[model samples]
Target: MGSVVEHKRTDKRTGKTVTQYRAHIRRVGFGSRSKVFATKREALDWIRNNESDNALTKRASAGGKTLASLIEDFIAAGVCQYASQAHLAYWCDQLGNKLVSEITHGDINGALLSLRTRGGRRFTPDGIKPSGKPLTPATINRYAAALSAVFNFAQAHGVIDAHPMKGGKVKKLKEGPGRQRILTPEEETRLLETARAARWDGMYLFVLMLLTTAARKSEVLNLRWRDLDLGRGIAVLGKTKNGAARALPLVAEVRKGLAELSKVRPINSDFVFYDPKQPGRPKNVDTAWQFVRERAGLNDSDDPVHRVVLHTTRHTGVTKIIRNGANLAQAALISGHKTLAMLKRYEHLAADDVLQLAEHALGKVGTGSSKG
Candidate 1:
């Protein structure tokens, strides 16, 4: 609803009275707007124009948004994880120009299928190049899950009446078994020795923490001094991929390495792995890690199944814990794995070890029967 009111005021310079018309509008779900005009007709005209535009805007927002715009809003809301944000950004590049209402199940399915052959983008000295390897079903599912989140956000916000991914319009592909790569004793020894001699003084400590703590690369890099309690020999991860805080136990060797590194810690920063150039930020050790891995002869092949990467350190740590007689629950606590299913992948054991355990248990029963 709207109304127009007339007012009279004395002009200070001319010492004359002037009249003006003020038009005011108040509508539900909209902010009130008022404007003054010299003539009542002009005031009424402005109100009519604004009201008409407002009605049109309301109608358009219901179904006229582009996928990119909705993605922008979703990002602004800051509800998704960091990894999902990257996936969503990739979607913005793929379907940004398309209208939300026009997107169909086929469109999404086709996009995911295309990802299989297209592979992941990799940066090389020559520029961006496709990895040439087809994306695994698990990787493809991650992309699908990211897109599903956006559609879910749109539905909750009333931007769309129905979910495009609903009713299993797009299904998750079956993922292969998880990687079971673990560092052999010789490889672990060689890796640590190489890291100790690397030019980057922090390399040894960083690798040691990863191998000992079973923490992710990002989690280790983001570690701060305050997060550590040297007396307790534990590191508190305040933020993790699972959005839960967990504590990582520090071994005697790790505690010694950290103690030595803290002696050279910069006074201006709290980050344990603070960048030399930017004291306020954590150091990116990708190049350093690559150098150490190559020098250690760990990068002999491009095979993902056997390739030793940063994440392999986590896998190694968890695998070693299970091999050393720790159960799945104990390993999950150290690895910060939220589910036992995810932790099960690292439960690899040697055939000899399994046989020995079976013999040890049955041997006692056989001895008792012989005595009887």
Candidate 2:
């Protein structure tokens, strides 16, 4: 139901009264928006149009919103803004012309199949070419997630009645274990030497932080100078992957490196690992990482598990922290993981070479259990 009210106002200079009509309505989950008009008839017309318009708009928009329109909304809202929105182009070609509301789980599966076969591209310095590697199930799930998010956003904004994802029905790609490469002490020494030899700003410090703290690349990169408590030897990471705040221990090596880097660090910038060129933002470490890994001769592995990348430092760090005697709860706090299940995934990645520690523990238990 809608109601109209005539608002009366008196002129300051002239002894005259002004009348205005305002109409307001509430449409349950569809939400509320109102319009005011000079004439009562105009307000009544707007109320009539808006009330009926919501219903008609829902039908027309749901029926006529093509996949291309969804992508447009996705970009506008910065859903997949990273990769310059090119990663989603394959989906645009497959489902761009189809209506969003009518798109089915079968359609999504079909698109995933197309990607796995020959529906995507690979870019080179010269131009675009057919992608050699087929899309992984994990990658396909990511695309499905992005698409589901588009629908979810629509539903949240009252553009659609409900999202079409319907839980995990549309997202059905089983993924195997994630990457699991731990760097040996020898490799660590060599990699650090290589990074220092290359002479890039923040490279050495960033590497040391990941190796020492088991912090993600994003968490390390997103750190501000203010986040550090130099006196207390702790770094507060507020923008962690789990979206919670945690304090990262600043080890002797990381603390020493930070002290040296702080001398040359930009005082104007807040970031601890900020780019010299763009002091406000984190330095782009990908190119430097690839270069250093290639220089150290560690980039030829076929399996992602064997790949010695920047994130390998985090894995190695976590495993080392646990091996040196931190429990799962301590590891989770250091790594900023929200759950033990996530730690279990890491445990699966890392080989258990500490069986001797378990034996030693059993020996202690047996000694303690002895009856005199």
Candidate 3:
């Protein structure tokens, strides 16, 4: 009930011909399945394993459940992480109509490939638009992982018998280094001045807190009066991206700004950046941020890494911390980076700083000339 077909194709990267095997399996009362493999042995092995598993689970019917329904059930189970919900919802939009049994490795793989090449839909001023840039390898992998979680949940609940993406059937793409952009002194000054003049009252304080505390945009925007301690010059982030609580040190300028902001705080809301129109919600700062960045000339660069965004302030803060004599561990404590590896991207030093450090350590070292 299975077959392996050999095919030859030119490798796009190497321009050399290579052989590939496509394994196909079909059993009574089961949908057809196929997967491509790099070697004949692999193809044969896949066919055998699938046939054996199908025989044992012949009574199970994954056909009754659609992927969309399964995704809804998975979401209802409360197992998905907050960040992964969007990615899982995307899979629902793509393959939701298909029955769980009809889904295959090739389907998932092709969808991921398309996601990498074509990017995803994004919201803009005009309306929904396709992203201008392709999703990075890391992003693609995240999408795949999120969908895989749905499949795993289905299998655990007896909604599906097998996972198409199991056992590393879908290989992850190699990810490059993370972005390391930091603002120059001139850029920082221009951004602050523009933010100070911004019509949005919270813009200046938000940007200042981002730079001084190295807090993420979400963290700063979600701040409440209870989270701040101006007397101790500290702000506690009770919830963070890494699921850990961390404290951010508020400098004199940041403390003074907050003190002023508190005086004008709305009597109705507790949020630091509460929307005036809807005091229950945080202010939508995206439009105001875009305006400020464009006015300050920070958005002139087309390169995403070089283009200044809210997160760029965090990078600038961490770099400045390191430049001002703080080691990686010390910087991590201030920036709330969960690990040194995650914080390593901000370990940038100027050539002048490196030269001075070298001079300071080896200025009086003597050569072995014996004075002869």
Best by lDDT: 1
lDDT tens string, model 2, 1-372?
Answer: 677989999877897998998887666544444567799999888778767855645656565778788778777875332223555676788889987767777888787777667644655656787766676776677777667767777777665655567856565678867777888888888788778866586687778788888888877888888899888999997656555789999998888888887888777788888888888888878778877788877787967557787889988888887777778898888888789877886665445755665665565664655531
What TM-score fits each model?
Answer: 0.75, 0.71, 0.73
Report the CA-based lDDT of candidate 3 relative to the real structure. Answer: 0.82
Ranked by TM-score, the better of candidates 1 and 3 is 1
Give a tens-digit lDDT track for model 3, residues 323-362.
8988889988888788999876665533347777776666
Error of 3 at 228 (Å): 2.5
Off by over 4 Å in 1: 1-59, 62-64, 82-86, 125-127, 266-270, 349-352, 363-372
lDDT of 1 by residue, 232-269 (tens): 99999987888789999999998998898899999999
- 182, model 1: CA deviation in Å? 0.5
In angstroms, the error of model 1 at 87 is 2.4
Against the true structure, candidate 3 reaches a TM-score of 0.73
> Deviation in angstroms for 242 in model 3?
1.5
Q: What's the count of clashing pairs in each model shown? A: 0, 0, 0
